[model samples]
Target: MLTNGLVVDLQQKNMKIALIGYGKMGRAIEDIATKVGHQVVLTIDDPDFDAETLKKADVAIEFTTPQSAVSNIKKCADAGIPIVVGTTAWYNDYNDACDYVLSKNSGLFTATNFSIGVNLFWRITEMAAKLINDYDEYDAFIDEVHHTQKLDAPSGTAITTAEKVLANFGRKNNWVHHENGIGSSTNELELSVRSFREENVPGTHTVSFKSDIDTIEITHTAHSRKGFASGALRAAEFMTGKSGIYTMKDLLNE
Candidate 1:
């Protein structure tokens, strides 16, 4: 919100938020939202939730599964509510989802990893990839770890990191998932993303540029869900008074 040629600090005022998906992330967002002077007006856990209730708040934050993310976003858009989505493995329909949200004149904020540190790490990865692209002696790889309960392998965070590296690192053709250090990649042009699931990991992602002499690495480890929650709150704040699809790029740039 540019008021008087200055960005409005949305966190300065209270916001009424509706939470879609009352799981761990939902609870985390609620905790941070309230502590920062915002209100969680509603929480929806059921997939068969009453879609009309989403209209009760200034913005809605969704942390549901991939299977339900599109439906939930459409419902929020239908109800004229701005929404911030934190679900992964749902991008097969992302373009259509954006079209539907835009058609409804609703704002949608989406992110793979909603941690400020992770986003910064991504930027740094991009910078390093760009600088090393012409070196011809380096190859890129990613490793991501999460809690056992996490549904997706490689994680949305790692996926975004791969995208950043691939965009700048000309030698990499595509990203391939691996487990137990075995990627089965047929060619070197494929970037490897190794995935691990442990008992209680919040999340950890590392990007490395390797050569025979030495290796360069960057890592971001999440201590808890608080960073994700906090960033989601900021995204919700940014989505207010807006109507269109937005992402971490928009929020961070602002």
Candidate 2:
């Protein structure tokens, strides 16, 4: 429903999207998709999920659990339907799913955190890590909090931040979940990441670099899930004809 004068007169491709999980994320994506003129052709929530119905969709948006994400991707790949997965905790099989999609000549884009703001925050964290790499004066740590219903600890955002810090800074090569109240010693640079579960909190991540003189911190907090929903809808628009593994960074680049 873009109505601006500068908007590109792109032809409206008839896209039939199949929603794999009809949970909160699914419902939000449905709303955003409809607002932007796409159709939700099918919705599958039962264990006895019908692949035939999913085959009718041009694309599938999956937000299921760790146990079912790979299977769902495999079914859709077999049906020749491109997919975008937002589910986490099943990433051990992520490259396997990418291989399956490539083998079938299909498209797959997966993201740990789908919010545009979160993606930008990731970029900023990388830049900060590079800046701190040359100076041994700062030590970094990450903390993330999500809703109590979230299944994974050290939410995906925290892990991404930790990885960025490790990649740009040589001080830390791995991350350990700091549960309870224990922290790493002063001599060792530790990227302490902690997760908190509370009711109704969408998501919040904080990355801090500390030193004796001053401390620098960066944080991004989601007021609601609407931002992620909008980003997924935009991603669907971007993945129409492309085939390969993609991320929110690719969407931003486009």
Candidate 3:
């Protein structure tokens, strides 16, 4: 299938897709899936969908809220179907979800942000974070912006970026969502992520490191939702015959 202009190979002869959320991203995935010769057998946005309906597809793609994500995923697993989850704010049960998939011997793929450019941007952020590790004077912070309708603050993308920074930069231990405040204290390891909500913004993320003399920043501003949708389609295709848990990093590395 063609994903964000890149071609990907699916192990199956053809794919039958089941979308668990029929919102903007789900609609975008449906458009791209049809264009690439896949069939969307089911599109569920409500609670009436059953396990039989879910089993009709080769893979299921979920894009719901945290409150609904795990239940939808477990249902797909119960149906013995592979699933791709794009929802955020539900990492607290990620391990349990993995165990469920493993028990069923079913496939599960997930990502915080499925845009190809954003995944590449993550690599760049990691590189910059490593460079800043040597120079402790350069402190790092994150800023994210999304549409008003988006539920979570600081964004799942921003949180992932912050985790990437903390992994590479030794001085940082935790990230604080400074909702409306930004200040550096003398003793605390304060790394803040600020979030903004505007109208019609697809998404935006900035990772910045500042010192006394200069500052460095890397930013990724999504022009539309199609990139995320395209990546999800690609992930679904990749998961057609796979088992166990996988991630966007694994897909990219493959």
Clashes of each: 0, 0, 0
The local lDDT score (0 to 100) that residue 153 gets in candidate 1 is 81
RMSD of each: 4.5, 3.5, 2.4
Q: How close is candidate 2 to the true structure, as a TM-score?
A: 0.89
- Which of candidates 2 and 3 is the stronger one according to TM-score? 3
**69-161 per-residue lDDT for model 2 (tens digits):** 999988888888888888888888988999999998888988888887788898899999899878888888888888888888877778888
lDDT of 2 at 65: 84
- lDDT at position 10, candidate 3: 34
- Number of clashes found in candidate 3: 0
The reply for model 2, stretches above 4 Å from the true place, is 1-14, 179-189
Task: Mark the 10 consecutive residues where model 2 has the least summed lDDT.
Answer: 1-10
TM-score per model over all chains: 0.93, 0.89, 0.92
Give per-residue CA lDDT, model 3, range 1-254, as digits (tens).
Answer: 55455444434356899999999888988887886688999999996678888878889999988889888888998999999999999999999999988998888999999988899999999998998789978888898888989988878999999999989998888888865335544434767888888899999999989898998989999988878987888788788878889999788993
What is the Cα-based lDDT of residue 53 in candidate 1?
82
If the candidates were sorted by their lDDT against the true structure, best first, what order would they fall in?
1, 3, 2
